[model samples]
Target: AQSVAQPEDQVNVAEGNPLTVKCTYSVSGNPYLFWYVQYPNRGLQFLLKYITGDNLVKGSYGFEAEFNKSQTSFHLKKPSALVSDSALYFCAVSRNSGGGADGLTFGKGTHLIIQP
Candidate 1:
């Protein structure tokens, strides 16, 4: 089974400061990891993904994530935080080993709070 864990319920950062949202995943084989953000009342929007390639994957909005196989972690990072960045972020994972084309397993979510 594939699973994602977001240990933090919320992450707080001052505007202009760097921000990090932790994420860890488990899968039977190579994992396809993804990040999504949800606004106040809007649906989730794709942020980035780590399908294959460089361990460090960059995504929209100046955000980037490092895929650590040893640790089975893909932590999202941004050099600077903005009020607009505050939102609910979710980490998802799917096994690359091929399962029926089902949906991805997602973590609960991490509420990012950027204080001005």
Candidate 2:
């Protein structure tokens, strides 16, 4: 089975401060990792993904993640957080796509509270 874990239930950061949301994944084969953020009454927005090639991938809203093969981790980072950045963040993973019937296993979302 494939799964991802976001250890922190909530992460608080002051505006303009750097922030990080940790994620670790376990999979049978090569993994496809993704990060999504959800705001109040809104749909999940794609933040970033780690499929192949680069170890560090940048995404929308100045967000970026590094795929660490040794540690099996893909932690999200931002140079400076904003109050609008406050949202529920989720880390998800799935087996490498092979037209298989495997679905993504999502982590318990971590609420990122950015204090202004």
Model 2 Cα lDDT, one tens digit per residue, 38-82: 999998999998889999999999999999999999999999999
How many clashing residue pairs appear in each of the predictions shown?
0, 0
Ten-residue region with minimum lDDT total, candidate 1: 94-103
What TM-score would each prediction reach against the true structure?
A: 0.95, 0.93
**Cα lDDT for residue 18, candidate 2:** 98
Q: Best candidate per TM-score, number?
A: 1
Model 1: number of clashes?
0
Clashing pairs in 1: none
Cα RMSD, model 1: 1.4
lDDT scores in order: 0.94, 0.93
Worst 10 residues of 2 by lDDT: 94-103
Q: What is the Cα-based TM-score of model 1?
A: 0.95
* Candidate 2 colliding pairs: none
